[model samples]
Target: MNKDKVICPCRKLTKGDILKAVEQGASSYKEVKKATKAGSACGKCKKQIKKVTKKALKK
Candidate 1:
């Protein structure tokens, strides 16, 4: 897990954190943030969150 994948560029959440939350069943922007503090910052990671959520939902 790269601690530098930058899941949320705004909140500075790495991919590992986000993916971990996803694995735990976080299926939305709010869930991601709540689960891993990913978008609790400037909010620039909205796009990335949505994308990850979409992918996660597919699984």
Candidate 2:
């Protein structure tokens, strides 16, 4: 798995998808979900998404 690539794994969301969500103003985990529909299913991607979201916003 790519460290910087945020994959939902469950939903298979790509790093670009998460990055775009962050760029679109998804600062929080829940907000990211709304923006990308990533962690909405299964919830397995919650931790990964959260971590990447944090890093993406800082960038």
Candidate 3:
């Protein structure tokens, strides 16, 4: 994923932000949401957030 790509436009968060959150121990969707507030807005980004989170987990 592109680190510069914005995943959650609602919170202006990028994939890198979510990845950092994952590295910080956010393994679940809810945890990533709580940590980065990625999908807390319109909810459209939840799926992408999960994908990014899973990708980060693989690393």
On TM-score, the leading prediction is 3
Off by over 4 Å in 3: none
Candidate 2 — which residues are off by over 4 angstroms? 1-6
How far off is residue 4 in model 3, in Å?
Answer: 1.0
Residue 9 displacement in candidate 2 (angstroms): 3.0
**Candidate 3, clashing residue pairs?**
none
Q: Which ten residues in a row have the lowest lDDT in candidate 1?
A: 1-10
Report per-prediction Cα RMSD to one decimal.
2.4, 2.6, 0.8
Runs of candidate 1 exceeding 4 Å displacement: 1-4
Q: How many Å off is the CA of 53 in candidate 2?
A: 0.3
Model 2: worst 10 consecutive residues (lDDT sum): 1-10
- lDDT by residue (tens digit), candidate 1, 1-59: 35468777766677767777888988787888888777767777778777877776787
In terms of lDDT, which candidate is strongest? 3
Candidate 3 residues 1-59, lDDT tens each? Answer: 57989999999999889989998999989999998888998999999999998878887
lDDT of 2 by residue, 1-59 (tens): 35456488777788788888888888888898988789888888788788888988877
Better of 1 and 2 by TM-score: 2
For candidate 2, the per-residue lDDT at 54 reads: 90
Clash-forming residue pairs, model 2: none
Clashes of each: 0, 0, 0
What are the lDDT figures for the candidates, one per model? 0.75, 0.81, 0.91
